[model samples]
Target: MPGFPRRLTSRAAAGLALLPALTILLVAHLGSTSWTIWISLTSSRMLPNSNFVGLRQYETLLNNDRWLVSAQNLAVFGTLMVVGSLLVGLLLAIAIDQRLRVENTLRSIFLYPFSMSFVVTGLAWQWMLNPTHGIQKLVRGWGFETFQFDWIVRQETVIYTLVFAGIWHAAGLVMAIMLAGLRGIDEEIWKASRVDGIPAWRTYVSIVIPMLGASFATAGILLSASVVRLYDLAVAMTNGGPGLASEVPAKFVMDHLFERGNLGLAAAAATSMLVTVVSIAAPLLYARSRARTAETRR
Candidate 1:
């Protein structure tokens, strides 16, 4: 072959080497997603079948009380998890960065929860939050007769319990993110702020936080994704609770997909979730892109 044709062949071989990863991505992710979209438009029963029914499944999904509640619960849970984790994680990181002793041990203690599967951790949290046997019992044993940490058992407050466990499980990851961001800052910044007579708290609030915007954004996105897919924790903790109080979208999808034998409805719910995620994520991505373009221009 001529030189140009040989060069083309070499480039084609390099591209072919990526085929395995591309195939996995398409098959495992995009393929399944496309199938789900197709199935959502059909009247599939326990297993998917080829009976097209247009938007009936979506209409039914829209009218579903459980699905509606799950959406609301996800909104509340997502907000709490993302904001609470960020604040608590930033505080933990700041405190640990204060030249304290045993910092590594403390960091490990905080981070170890992130390493464990939420299945076990969620169950452990459930046990700890159990009304008759856990915190209430232990505290009551200490002679406080009216201590009520029984929110976990209440329909109105069970979602908050999920938030608590979620924060516990996820804040460590946030802490690690923020801590890494903090460490990357120049030591001169801290010294200059100190020399300028700025209080450490003000310095952190005004100067450090702005500098750590990328870190906060990263942690927030991670937490938001976790919140969207918050099934395992809810299942292990409340099992959709005292009359569907803690129902979330992922659990709703799973229930319909398996137990209810309504793949169409499940697919509709999944599509709704995807839409919601895109709706929320699109603006953030657009803003980030614009910011990058402006920075590059500057």
Candidate 2:
């Protein structure tokens, strides 16, 4: 009973210390999200007038062809970007783990692109992919006039260029992550596999990859957020063109909120995107939390 007051006092002190953060969470995050939701429910335009109109903005947003196209582009882009980055990163990580002579140089070369901002990545790729002034011109000058590598200006294939640039920028970070995970793996496991005469590639595919679940999850979540929040890249590269070919949800929301001067519709689009991300992420986070708890208990 004598320890109860001390424990109580400690808990109280901890709570008091966290009060500022709690207040910020309530006001900054919840309050802002609530306001955005309310805006979506209204007939807001350039000005945030409070004329309530339930679900109308969302209906209009769903019907809009640009929004639909943007959503479609996001699905394709996100899938390819995630898969491509993960594969490229994992391969780089494995190569580095092989004790290459120039490991540091190779790692830096791969990672250099990730240190750049999306704006820079997009602009650089835009120049490199330019049909007349870039790769195509350079190649043709070198005696290959029939060679065709221009996809950025073509509406049907512009999105793939975005995916290529995105994966290029992102793969290095994923490689770093996967390499860290690979390092943590017990050397004993490798020795055991060697003792069993298992082939290296088969071991990596069958056992090592399964063990890197945490790294994979981390990279996946990071890439997912980038996919949802993608704006700068699209803006810099195509400006959502070759006629909305590379448009994404974040760009769609920005266009309506500012350029289109329709806050209600923008809010609706924003809320939908937010909800989609949260829905996908929440379950994974919860499962991770439960796994951690179970491991602790064990």
Candidate 3:
């Protein structure tokens, strides 16, 4: 009976400790979501209005070119960012997992970018990618006379610059995740593969990679969320410049909300982004849940 009381006390204390976090999530997330939905239905502009405009905001949001461009940009940017980051990160992880001579130093160098703020990363890249004073200039000064790598200032290529930065920043994070996954893998499998005269690459492609399904999922989901909420990086790097070339959903919503003073439209844009992200993420989340359940049963 005395031990039971102690256990109860510990449980109670743990619940109390979590109370604040739960409260914040409920109030901040749920409450804001409700408010956004309500605003989207109204004719709010410059300030909140309860004009009850029905689906007028949604209609306008769907029809707007800026929103459409933002959506398209998101597709390209999100895809490239996720895929490139995964590939680079996986490669880095594999390389480091090889028990290199400078393991710790190399790992820290790779991971250094992930620890920096996106704004900082974007700003740094922006300078480096600038034509007159950055990469191009540096290259030209080295006697090439016409070496140009100014993707940041080009309408057709500005979004790709974002992708480049996104991959560079996120690859380290993916590497960390993959490294953990690789490390957890049973060494016996590697020995067995080698004994069977299987190539290392083939072993990774067929066996080890499949085992790291969870790592891939985690990296993808993380990158997906970052892609959706990709405001700070765009702001710092390109400011959605080159005539709406690198515009993304988050930036579109923010521009409408603050600059254009169209609260209802902004809410609609925000809600649309939320729906798109949920549509993409729900299946992934469900699959991951099912896999976890199967793992537990096994």
RMSD to the true structure for each prediction, in A, is 1.9, 2.3, 1.8
Q: Model 1 residue 194 lDDT?
A: 98
Sort the predicted structures by lDDT, highest score first. 2, 3, 1
lDDT of 3 by residue, 211-290 (tens): 99889988988998898899999999999998889889999999989999999999999998888878977897798889
lDDT of all predictions: 0.93, 0.95, 0.94
Clashes of each: 0, 0, 0
- TM-score for each predicted model, relative to the true structure: 0.94, 0.93, 0.94
- Residues 1-298, candidate 1, lDDT per residue (tens digit)? 4699989989999889999999999998999999999999999989899799999999999899998999999989988889999999999999998979899999999999999888888899999999899999999999998998999989999999999999999999999999999999999999999999999999999999899999999999899888888999999988998798999999999999989999999998999899889998999999999999999999
Query: Looking at model 2, how many pairs of residues clash?
Result: 0
Candidate 2 has its poorest 10 consecutive residues by lDDT at 273-282
**Alpha carbon lDDT at 141, candidate 2:** 95
The number of the candidate with the highest lDDT is: 2
Which scores greater on lDDT, model 1 or model 3?
A: 3
Cα lDDT of model 2 by residue, 216-243, tens digit: 9999999988988899999999999998
Deviating ranges (above 4 Å) for candidate 3: 1-15
